[model samples]
Target: MVVGLREVAERAGVSVRTASNVANDFPHVAPETRRRVQAAIEELKYRPNTAARQLRRGRTEVISLVVPEISSPYFSELAAITVRVAAERGWTVHIDQTDGDADQERRMILGPAGRSVDGVLCSPWAVSPAELVELAAGPVVLLGERETDGVLDHVAIDNVRASREATLHLLARGDRVIGAIGAQPHLQNGTAELRVEGYRQALESAGLPFRTDLVMPVRSLHRPDGAAAVTRLLEVEPRVDAVFCFSDELALGALRTLLEQGRRVPQDVAVVGFDDIEDGRYSTPTLTTIAPDKTQIVRVALDRLAARIAGQTGSGAEAPLDLVVPHRLLIRESTTSVRTRKG
Candidate 1:
C-alpha cells in the first residue's frame, strides 16, 4: 500500500497541514508537536512525494548557494551547514563558486530568471548594490550584508560590532598599536568595510588615532594575503604590538608570518581573527577569534527563502529583512599572555 502524508498526520494526531509544515521544515512549529510529527513519519516510513509536489507547485525545489570560494574554511563551514539544513527541508542546493569574480557573481545572481533554480543564496563579493537590485530575477537571499535598502534580505551578524568587540578585547588586555588586516575597499558587499569600521571604532573608542598605514587592504582573505599584509605592517609600523585579522585564514597566515619574523604569540604580539574555523583551534598558539552561530545563520536564511518561494507578498514584503544573529569573541592561546602596555 502506498503511504501518504495523511497516514502520518493521523498517526501523529496532527492536521495534514501541520504534518506538511513539519515535513517542509517550515519554522513556527512547536517543538513537541514537531517531535511527534517526525516520530510518526519515521514509524510510517513515509517518504514525501517530492516530484509530485514540485510539479504541482511549479518549483524545482533547488536553490543555488553562491560563494566566493567554497575552499575557504569559513565558506566551507557555512556551506556544510547550509547543505544539511536545506536537505532537511527536502530541497536541493547547487553550489556555485564565483571566486569573487564580477562576471561570475553576476551570472549567479541573475541566472535564476525563470530558470531551473527556484531561488539563490549568494555570498557575493564583487557585485555592486545597484547591479544586485537591477539583476535580481527571483527570490534571492544574500548570505551577507549589502546595504540594499530593502531590496534584499540580509542574514548576518553585526560585522561592525563583532569586529569592534574583538579589537576591544585586545585593547582591554593592554595591547596597543594594533593593526587590522582585511579591507576590501574596492568591493561593494560591505562585509569587509563593516569589519574594518569596527576595528576603527574600537581604536577610536580607546583614544588611539587611526592611521592609514596601520590598516591593510588585501586582494583576498586567504592565508597568503594575511601573511603578506602582516609582513607589510611589520615593515611599516615596527612597533605593532598586536593585530586583528578579519578571517581565521588570514589570522593563521598572520601567525605563521609573525613566527617567521621571530615574533612570539601574545608575548610579543597578540592576534585575533574572525570566523572560528576548526584549524584555528589547533594552530600552534591557537587563534583568538569571533565565532558566529553558523547554524542559526543558515536556518534563518533558508526559512526566509522558503517564505519567499511560497509567494510572500504584503505591505511589508518590500521591506528588507536584516536578521542579526549572535556572535561572541573567543579568547584562545594566541592571546594567552597579554603584551605589556608601553608606558
Candidate 2:
C-alpha cells in the first residue's frame, strides 16, 4: 500500500496541517512535533510529489540562463557551474543561446521562453535596456554589463579596471607598442568598448601614445576573428611588440597565426588574453589572462535569482542590486619574457 501524508500525520499523533508544515520545512513547528513527524515519515518511507507541491505553490522551480554563444568555453563552463548550483537548490536550469543577435536576444528576453521559466539569468550581448524594460515580464538577473538603468539585479566583474590592469601589466613588462586585438564598435553595451577604454587609460597613464591603428576592430571575438585581426595587425604594424586580446578564444587564434608566421611568443610578440579558459593553460605557450571569479559569479547570480523566485526584494524605493565580482591577472609563459627589440 502507498504511504500518504494523512497516514504519516496519524502515526505521528499530529494534525495533518502540522505534519504538512514539517514536511515543507516550515520554521514555526515545535521541536518535538517536528521530530515525531520526521520519524513517522522515515518509518513509512513517504515521498512528497514534487510536481504537486510546486503546483500548489505556483512555482515551477525552473530558471533559464541565456548567453550569446554556448560553444565558447567561457559560456559553456558557466553553464556547467550554473547546472551544479541549481541542482543543489532543487531547481532545474534551462540553457539558451542567442548567437549575439539583437533580434534573437530580444525575443529570448521577452518571448514565451522567458514567460515559461520562473526567472531568467542572462548575459545579454545585443538586447537594449529600453527593449528589456518595455518587454521583460519576468524576474531577470543580468550577467554582464547591460545598461538596465539600475532597475534589475546585475552581476559582473569590473571590466574597465580589470582591462586597465591587464594593459598596465604589459606596459610594466616593457612592451611599448602593445596592440589590442578586440574592438566591437557597433554594440552599445559591448564589453570590448570598456576593455579598449581601459587599454587607452593605461596607455595615457604610461605616457605612451594611443595608436588608433593598433586597436584591431573585429566583428566578433571568435578565433577566426582573432586570427584575421592579428593578420591585419601584422600587415599594418609589423613592429608591434605585444598584443592583448579581449578573450582567450581570440588569443588562441592569434597564437596560431603568430606561429605560422614563425614569430616566437614573448620573444617576437608577447600575448595576453581575457577570460582564462582552460585552453589557455594547455596551449603550447600558455596564455596570460584576466581570470574572473567564475565560482563567485555563479553563486551570486543564483542566490539573487533564488531570492527573486522566493519573492524577496528590498524596499520599493531602494535601488536594484549590482554585484561586482573580483578578477585576477594570471601571468603565464605567453607573456613571460620582456623583448628588448620590437617585432
Candidate 3:
C-alpha cells in the first residue's frame, strides 16, 4: 500500500503527465499546478524511487568525491560537507581516497570503479596535467587543487593569496627569517606550488632575503611529516623565530617538537599554519592559522555535480563556476611574540 506518482496526481487533481512535469520543474507547467502537485506529494509522502528515476533518465544520480587523504581535518570536514550538500540535493555521494599516490589517482579517474558515479569531484595529488586533461572526458569538478589547461570546472581558495596573507600576518607581527614547512618542491599540480609562490611573494614584498634553506620540503603533508620538517627547519636556520606550516597537521607536529625541545610557543617561536582545524584551537597555546569557507566550498561543489548528473550540461547547472573561497588569518595564542634566547 505505497503511494505512487499516479496517486499523487489523482490527489492533486492533475493528470500524471502534469504531475511529472511539475516534479521535473518544466517551465510549461503553471505555478498553481506545480504548487498543487507539490502539496499532493507532501500529503502523500510519495518519495520518488531514486533507482527507478536514474534508470529512466539514464543517470546514476551519484557523485564521486575523491580526496588524497581523509585523516586530516581539512579533508574530513570537506567530506562531511560534500556528503551533506549532496544529500540535500537528493544525490548520493561516494568517497575515494588515493593516498596521494600517482598510480592510484590515475586508476580512480580512469578505472572501471570510477564509471559507476555520474560525475567526479576530485582533489587529486600526483595527477599530472596530461592525465587531468584525459580525465575530463567525464563531467568533473576539481577542488582544493589547481585546474590544468582549464579543461574542467574547479572551485578552490586562492592558495597563493592565502599563503601570502599568512606570511604577511607573521611579518606584521615583526618576525623575519620565517621558515616554511611545506609539501615537495617542484610539484606540478596541487596547493603546494601555489603556497610556495605566495611565500616567496611575501618575502619579496618585505625585502627579506629568501633563503632556500628555510623552505624545508617534505613528501607528505601529514603530522609526522610536519614534525620531521620542523626538525630540519631548525637545523637549517638555528635562529628562525617564526614558521609557516602549509597544513595544520604539520603545524601540530611542529608544536609537539617545539614543546619537547623546551621551547615555549609564541614565547620562544611563533608558528602559523593553514587550514585552521579543531586541533589547532585546543592545542597547547592554540595555533594561529588560515581558514577557508568550507561550507561554501561543499555547497557549490555539490550543486555543480548535481547539474552535471541531471544532464543539464550547459545552462541548467554547469555554468563554468571557477570559484575561490575567501580565507582569513585566525591569530591565536600560538603566534604572539618570539622571546627565545639564542643558544
Candidate 4:
C-alpha cells in the first residue's frame, strides 16, 4: 500500500495545499504546520509523487551529469559528489558517459538525453564551443576546461597553472630530461592542450629546451595508454630522469611499468601526476599530484545550475560565470626525498 499526500494531509489535520507546501519546502509554511506535516509523513511513510509534483510546479527536479568515461576514477568520484550534492537539495541526478566521442557528446548536448533533465553538468572532451552554442539543449554548467564563449557556465581549476606547478616541482628536485606523458594532441581538448602548455612553460622558465622526443602522446588517459607511452619513452630516451603525467590514472600505470622494469621510484626516476585520485594515494610509492578542490567544484557548479534553473539569469542581464576552483600540489613519496641524477 502506497501512502499519498491526501493521507498525510488528513493525518496532519491540514488541507492538501498546506501539506504540499510543507513537503515542497515552501517558505510560507508555519513551523507548527510543518512539524505536524513532517510527523504525519514519517508515521505514514508517505512518498510524494515526484514526477507529478514536478509537472505541476513546472520543473523536473532532475539534473544530468555527463562525463567522458564513468569508469575513470576521477570522473566517477566527481559523479558521486554531484549525486550527493543534488540529493541534499531534493533533486535527482542522471549520469551519462560519452566515451570521449565527439559525435556522441554532441548528441548528448543536443539530443533527447540532454532535453530530459532540468539542467546539465558536463565535462566535455571533444565538443567545441561553437558546437555547444549551436546545439545547446538547456541550462548547462561545464565541469572541465572548455571554451564557452562567455555564454555557458563553467567550473574548473586552472589546468595550465596546476600543471606548470607540478612540472616545476619536478624540476626543483634537480630532475632534468623529464618526459611528459598523456599529451592528447589528436583530441585537441582544452584540458590536454593547457596541461601541455604548462609543462612547456615550466621547461622554458627553467632554461630547459623543449624536446619533441620527450613528450609522449596518448590517445586516451587510461592505464594501458599510460603504460604504453611510458614503454615508448623508455625505449627511445632510456636515460630520462622523471616524468610528469597529466592524470593520476596514467601515473599509476607508469609507476607499475617502472616497477616491472626494475627501476627504483624517485631513485632512478621521479613521477608526478594530476587529478589526485584515491588510487594515487595508495599506490606503492604514493603519487605526487595536483589536487583540485573537488568539494568546491561540486558546490559551485550545483549552485550555479540551481540558480539557472530558477530563472535567475533574467533575460541576459548577467554574463555567464566561469569559476576557477583552487588547486594544490601534494608532495608525496613519489617525487620527494630522493637523490636526483642528471640523465
- The Cα RMSD of model 3 versus the native structure comes to 5.4
List per-candidate RMSD values in Å: 7.5, 4.5, 5.4, 3.9
Q: Could you say which candidate leads in lDDT?
A: 1
Candidate 1 wrongly placed segments (more than 4 Å): 1-56, 312-316, 337-343
Candidate 1 lDDT = 0.88
- Enumerate residue pairs that collide in model 2: none
Model 3, position 314: C-alpha lDDT score? 56
lDDT of 2 by residue, 116-208 (tens): 678888887887665665666777888877445787778989888999999999999899999999998887565778898899999999999
Count clashes in each candidate, considering only residues at least 3 apart in sequence or on different chains. Answer: 0, 0, 0, 0
Model 1 lDDT tens row, 6-124: 99999999999999999989999999999999999999899988677877777887988989999998999989998899999988888989988999889877875346678889887
Please list the residue runs of candidate 2 whose C-alpha ends up more than 4 Å from where it truly belongs after superposition.
1-53, 112-115, 312-318, 337-343
Ordered from best to worst TM-score, the candidate numbers read 4, 2, 1, 3
By TM-score, the better pick of 2 and 3 is 2
Better of 1 and 3 by lDDT: 1
Clashing pairs in 3: none
What TM-scores do the predictions have?
0.81, 0.83, 0.80, 0.87
Q: What tens-digit string does per-residue lDDT give for candidate 4 at 248-343?
A: 989989999998998999889999988989999888888999999998899999999888878744676356888999999999989976545478
What value of lDDT does candidate 3 attain over all alpha carbons?
Answer: 0.81
Which window of ten consecutive residues has the lowest lDDT sum in model 3?
312-321
